[model samples]
Target: MNASLLLSITPYFPRPISSRRQCPLTVRRNARLQSPLCLASSSAPIATRETEIELENRKFELLRAVTDIQRGLTATPDQRSSIEESLVGVETFDAGKPIELDLLDGTWRLQYTSAPDVLILFQSAATLPFFEVDQIFQKFECRDQSGQGVVRNVVRWSIPRLLEEQEGATLIVSAKFSVVSVRNIYLEFEEIAIQNINISEELQALIAPALLPRSFFSLQILQFIRSFKAQLPVRSSQRQSVGGLYYLSYLDKNMLLGRAVGGGGVFVFTRAQPFI
Candidate 1:
C-alpha cells in the first residue's frame, strides 16, 4: 500500500482495541477443546435447543439481508446503519466470554467488503493481459496467551496468459500485520512490513505497455503492487498506519460475517482451504 492508498482508508476503527488482553466477546461451538489453552465456554447464556433454533433463523435473516445489500450498489444511509445494527445485535455468538482460540485462528477469505479499494481490486481485473481473479483475504493465529498474534492479508491471484497459451502464473501480494487488539468480536491490524515483490516475467510481460490512458488498473498503477512488495526488511514507521477495527457479527465453523466500524462496510467470509 502507498501513501495515497493509506490516505484513502477511512477511519474504519472508531476505537483502538486495547493493547492489554481483555475479555473477548462470544462464540458458538458444539465441540470443546481438550487442550489446556482452549475451551468452549462463555458468560452468555448457554443456548438451549430452542435458542439455538431461533439463533439459526436470525442468522438466516441476516445472511439474506447481507446478500440483498451486496447486490445493490446504492446503499442508503439507513440501510448501512441497519446493516451495522443488525450485525452488532446479532446473537449468533455469546458476549463477555472467554476468548476462544479456535474461533480466532485460521485463514478468512473475504466474501464481501464495503471498502471502495476492495471494489477497485475487482474492477481492475480487465487490465491484466492475463486473466485476473482474486479475493482479498486474511489469516491469523492466536498465541498461547489470549492476547495477541500475527496476521497476514494475501492478495492471491490466478493470472493466466490466455492469449499466449502459457500456464497462468500464481501471483501473490502479501501484507504483514501485527495484532494490536484481540477482542473476541473485533480485531485491529497494523501493517508492519511488506515483502519485496519480484515482478515475474509473466507479469512483466502482461503490463509492459507504456500505459493505458485514464484507467484504474493500467500498467503504471499496477506497479504500486511492486513498491508495496519491495523492501521487506524495513518496518513502516507510519505518520499514519493503515489498519481497521473489524466488528464480527457472526462466526461458526464454516462462515463469518463482520462489519468494519464507522459504517465502512460489511463483509462475508468462509473458511479457506489450505488453512494457515
Candidate 2:
C-alpha cells in the first residue's frame, strides 16, 4: 500500500514504442557492409522475429502491471474514502434491497441503476479490485394458469470478480442473471446459503501465508461461532423454542464440556432425619 511499493512495481508495465520508425533496408545494407552477405541475411530475419516477440512480451507485462496497481487500490483505505466522498451528492440506496434485473438465456448483461456521477465514483473505487465479468446460466420449466408445463424463460447477467489477463491487462466487475424458475431460484438461494465455502488445498497454496496463519484461522472460527450464537434470537414461547437449548445439548454430548459433565455424578439424598 505504500507509494514506494507502487513505484517499484511500475516498471513491470512496458512503455510504449517510440513513434519514430527505423528503415529495415538501410539497417540490412549496413549490416551487409560490416559482415558477410550470407551472415547478414540469416541474422536479419532472426532479429526481426526476436523484436516482434519482445514487443508482444512487453505488452503483456504492461497489462499485468496495470492490473496489479488497480488491485492494490481496491485494498487501500484512502481510495475507498475518496470514492465515498465523491458519491456524497448522489442518492444512496439501502444496502439490503435486492437489485432488480432481467435476463435472456445463454447471454449475460451488465446494467447500472445509480446516477452517472455515483456510477463514475463507484467504478473508480472498484476499478482495481475486479478482473472480469461473465454470465452464468441455468434452465427452468413453469406452468401457466391452465396447469400445463412450459419451458418458460432464460436469464442473463454479468458476474463480477472474473479476472481476464489477455485483454488489455484489466479487471472488471459486473452483474449477471439467469432464468426464473423454482429450481433456478432454489439453486441461487442455495448458493447464498453456503456462500462461506472454505478454500480448497489448491487455493490455499495460492494465498499469502501471512493471511492464513494458525492464529488467524483460530480467530476466524471463534468469530464465526460467536456470530452464530448472537444470531439465535430468544423466543418467549418456551425453553424448547430457543436454539440455545439445542446448542447446549450438542455441546454437552460431543464436546469437552460433555465429558466434564459426565464426570460429575448426581448428589445423594439423605433420609435419616425425614421422620422427625
Tens-place lDDT digits, model 2, residues 53-157: 654454333223323223222325554343333222121211223212211112211111112422343454456454332221122222122211211111111
The lDDT values for all models are 0.53, 0.28
lDDT of 1 at 247: 58
Model 2 poorest 10 in a row by lDDT:
250-259
Tens digits of per-residue lDDT for model 1, 137-240 = 66766646445565666664544533212212223333333333433333344443333344555656566644545356665655675555432332336644
Q: For candidate 2, what's the RMSD?
A: 28.0
Those runs of model 1 whose alpha carbons end farther than 4 Å from true positions after fitting are 1-47, 68-86, 89-93, 126-131, 158-244
Clashes of each: 3, 14
Please provide TM-scores, in order, for all candidate models, with all chains considered together: 0.51, 0.19
Once superposed on the true structure, which residue ranges of model 2 sit more than 4 Å away at CA? 1-35, 69-276
